[model samples]
Target: MNEELLKMLNAINSKKEEAKKLVMEDKIEEAKTAKDELIKLQNKFDIAKDLFDQQEKSKDEEIKNKVKKLTVEDEEKKGHNAFVNVFTAGVLKKAVNEEDVKIYNQMTEADPTEGVSDGGLTVPQDIRTQVKELRRSLDALEPFINVEPVTTLSGSRVIEVNADQVPFDNVDEAAQFPDVDTPKFKNISYKVVKKGGILKVTRELLQDSAENILSYLTNWIGKKARVTRNFLILNELDSSFGGDKTKTLNNFDSFKDIFNVVLDPSIAISSSVLTNQDGFNWLDKQKDSDGKYILQPNPVNATQKLLFGRYPVAVVSNKVLKSAVEGAPEAPTGYKYPFYMGDLKEAITIFDRESLSIEFSNEAGDLWGKDLTGAKVRERLDIKTIDTEAVVKGEVSVTV
Candidate 1:
């Protein structure tokens, strides 16, 4: 636009200079003709230029109006889902990165599902990086999860999710509980994930249930404990068994079946053997009952205790259970599996008849280590390394 305007201005200025020269030479008739021609050309140019300027100004005004319309200030009163897409994207990156690292690092002996590891990090890193790039396009958006405002369009006001095709039920209370930016996604819905600031999973958190689970997991499991998980949907089951893998007393399924049977009945469990020591006196350490050992007799009061007297119960599907119980036990009613007596201490599961099951085998696929037990999750946004004393003793640092 400026270039074209300059061209026109220069044309008029040059013609004016020529006309002045024609007058200075005292060539009156020639000067009049030259002046008249210049005036006519200038008038012709103005006619076309007026329309062009009008169009240009109109375009400028239109763009300015659009800029005003999209202002964050304008959207503030509207519950505009300014950040939904970008937020969801960020959420997605965090979830996938965590999942990939977690599932990949799981006990390889148990999974036997090996893939090539990339510098100790999996190839999923590539996918997360790509998603983050797409997320960058949303930088202009204000980070938001908008709630629909009540409007006179109907009556009073209405609260609705503004995102199209995304689950816009309500503000994910989980999105900001236990302090903002705290880990809350897994507790909110173990299956549901955040992506592009959108709900990208099949589940939603039941506020009360999620809160309780989060609390329990936080209390039992240390906040710093690294939990690894792999979500598997049991679409079909091979519920048949007869040979070496069958549920006879000495077989693998038999042991798993027994443990499953005992654990399924309750959410919690207790082992009197661990919690109650008749001859040994753990209580004796607190005989004076001061400082760290401040309580005597029952250190665990009616409400609080750091120790889990027994192994915690876990949830598994009925199909897995039925498959485990495919073969019947041949033992007498009073008889028990040798594992129940804690016989295999070094490399086998120790299954006690009363209340505890010790998972000891390196190859044993125990569900206990497979999940976060519904703890809230937050990504560190940076790589971390295992720096235990063993590494120090070896004069090495195991980094990831």
Candidate 2:
């Protein structure tokens, strides 16, 4: 099936090139014929790919059944033991004991393609799911932004409306319709980039119970993934609107102006405030004329803080959203804390290409000699800002 899909894809590419050549040669009819064939081939490829995915899912179910049988046979052991056994065997290049051998044999019998040579053993589905959940839970910014799951490596999305443009006009009945501003559509393209790191494990840690090992690995990977994604997202927001859209707010009244005067009401309605701990500290110190703190607890979610009792404030740690250090001696506190207010879901989009993939190795470098193994984990995704006008960036400075 994979071979057939590749062949079809190649044919489509060839047909596309042929059509381009025909168009260049002024043969419109020939180009049209080639394009029709190309479309047909694309449809066939889609069908085949869907079928292939179904078959792969079916195989995964079968593998799960085999794992279930193994668990039943060893009622005292945890379900994660099977994964531990596989990991041990892959790293050691051999089974450690009779039970390890039995478990490894069952896994290979269930899925022959999971050998160490085949791009390392794909982490078990259950563990992968847990890791994914942990990552999402730990990431502070992901829940509020637009997240899109995509299967392809690269693609483009059409933005239907220009955020800054007013494309509508009012007209009287029976009057000649005046030409309103035409809606300008924009295309945002994304390509997934691989982000990964290696986790070095000591021999003693690997010797722990299966559940403990799994817990430790998942926690580490989850936090690392969260930090990596947060860094990328914050950087994207800064680069997109940090230039002309940035504002400087000193007092409580100026901060209020972000929503009241800086941003359009349409955008302000759906906007939230994002700031570092330093900026939040500044806001926390502000009081109204009645001596009430401007930042109050959110009415709906008491645990969350709200700015002006309207917009929720998301406070990122100063470590994650670092302040810029000033060069001059007279600069207040020598740092500028970043503050962002906007509809983040409209401002940024995250294209998730695939889930977390982990591979273990004992032979990497001098691991065998030092009795240390490395677990390499990788994630693929892309981040893009679709609407710059939806967000306002601010930098706040205060004297010590």
Candidate 3:
């Protein structure tokens, strides 16, 4: 839009210059004609300029309008600033090892626990934020999942399907008409799942070292959650939802052939491809008759790779989409590399009930005998396949 406006403005300036040149050359009649055309162009330019100005806004101003305002209380509750005192202000007196005590202070300063009375610590907000950011960056399946932060732990999403009533080929000019199709709705529920692990840290390490233990712990837990969530998403995508076997692509074919089977023509152009490393490797090696690579760089995001110059590609781990093995006749050959393609935004939904939560216990049975403190991190989330038909799955094996 901005580029178009700039071109229009340049044209207007050029016309004005031509009109001025005509007047300077003493061509009175020609100048009048030029000025007349200039006036008309100016009118159109004025309308376009007004529209352009209205549409263009400072990026900072736009960001400010979209982002929620932070209050003083919220600011105060943010990072190390909030937890520094809670963990360092004579909180852990029982841990006698000075080295362990130093490590604990460093951890607390990084991510302070809310209540230190029961030897349990509430992870700081900044640590949680950092962990989530890291997880999003590292998680391969994150790009393809539709994430929604919901207040409730469990809720239902309604998927609407319109009846496939054929359009009338011919009808009387004044004849009565009926409804084209009835809409059908399918209700799918999302139920949160809880996952957490307890880890023991020695008192010496907690008190002695200057390492950012909180960041390390939060990152570990965040990655663990991402792995678990990706596995669940893969399972949901592979499930026999609605028994729509037509959406499956079990054999190798041309891009158009496979894409047509997996996605509707109307929504096929801007889609996504999710598969294992083997699947992407095969796609990356594909070429046209001229030997040009079939896959292209995504225009929307320069950092991303696109399939056939259209769909973005995400390569999941073999655990989610099994890798292929060649030269073994006895081994499984069919669907070894599961490939899923479609508008995942319309198919898969992830509901986050709560952000990540971290809790610590000094007296946990698992760590009590070992003189270590236990930390557990958990999050509440769920995945749902909103539209089974919108997503297509297939298997392809290609050697590169």
Candidate 4:
């Protein structure tokens, strides 16, 4: 548009020059015609300039609207941050601004289902998501087992096929059907239980920034929650296995038999080996007759180790999965470590209530006298073994 206007203005200027030349040359009629053409060109230029100005104005308005939308989004983010700061101050039982008290109350009183009146405050959604991600880093057993989210405090899941059964018999056409054996079912019941602990914070730590305070709290809660769940699942796995089913890995051949002979072919296809750090260390040192290491790098995941070039091996901390020494005095001592191999997802199920609640107290125990604050975090969940045959509990012992 601007270019068009520039061209029109240049044409008008030329016509004016032509008109002036004609008048100087005494061409009166030609000069009048040139003057009329110059006036018409000026009018067209004026119209085009107005339209260009309107277009520029429209573009400016569009830019302003976008800026205003971005400002609103930034303000919303600032508001949420302010709320989190106020809530964090309240949790630490520190002094909060009077104007921001409403924000704190909104967080506490917004959800009656969370039992806020009883002093329990639900962790903010964003913080919860962060904590969950952190918890996964510390988890060992939870990721492998089947997790079922449940709303009820207590419930039961019925298993129609507990074990492999015989297939139906063939029948002739138009012949009477033969009677079949009644199917058996096993009911696995679970009741959610509370697992929680108190984390004490020094007065100095409470005075830190809200982000730092939340980070400390989340790290503590995530680790504790993961450890509690891992302990419960491991306990259930131990209880499900019978003495007859549990075996000792005396040599490399014995370890291979766990997948080839002990576990069912169907279960072995999807099985993984689980052991503590101590057991893994022993297995990592094993060698074949050709002097090659038995533990190979997993083809699918290079970070993980595979046994028999097939099953993935999962290693947990020795502190979590402890080792036991068995044998009489003066005899060769056996450092027995757990070597559980099987399809863990099909073996156990965790009924998760999916609720984590936190409460704060300044007067709990010696916190008040010490000028410290205590935050109590609680988690609810239940674990049960669905199939005992899905896993083989083997003890890998290092004898000396």
C-alpha lDDT values of all predictions:
0.29, 0.79, 0.64, 0.79
Per-residue lDDT of model 2, residues 194-268, tens digit only: 999988878788688887888898888878877888888888988997977678877667767888887878889
Residue pairs clashing in model 4 are: none
TM-score of each: 0.22, 0.70, 0.63, 0.73
Which residue pairs in candidate 2 have backbone atoms (N, alpha carbon, C) closer than 3 angstroms, thus clashing?
none
What is candidate 4's lDDT per residue for 1-400, written digit by digit as tens? 6778889999999999999999999999999999999999999999889999999999999999999999987754544455445546656555555444454445434443333334456665556666677777853578888999999999999897734584577899999999877778888999999989988868676567756767787788888878888888878888887366678778888877888898889999999998899889998998999999999998789999999999999999888888776787557477788888999999999898877777778887898898776778887888988987899888876777
Arranged by TM-score with the best first, the candidates are 4, 2, 3, 1
Best by TM-score: 4
lDDT of 4 at 225: 78
Per-residue alpha-carbon lDDT of candidate 3 for residues 239-286, written as tens digits (9 for 90 to 100) = 733234523333335456757654676557657787777777777887
Off by over 4 Å in 2: 1-79, 95-111, 163-182, 328-332, 363-366
After TM-score superposition, what is the CA distance of residue 178 in candidate 4 from its true location, in Å?
7.3
Q: Identify the superior model by TM-score, candidate 1 or candidate 2.
A: 2
Ten contiguous residues minimizing lDDT sum, candidate 2:
110-119
Identify the superior model by lDDT, candidate 1 or candidate 3: 3
* RMSD of each predicted structure: 29.4, 21.8, 13.1, 8.3
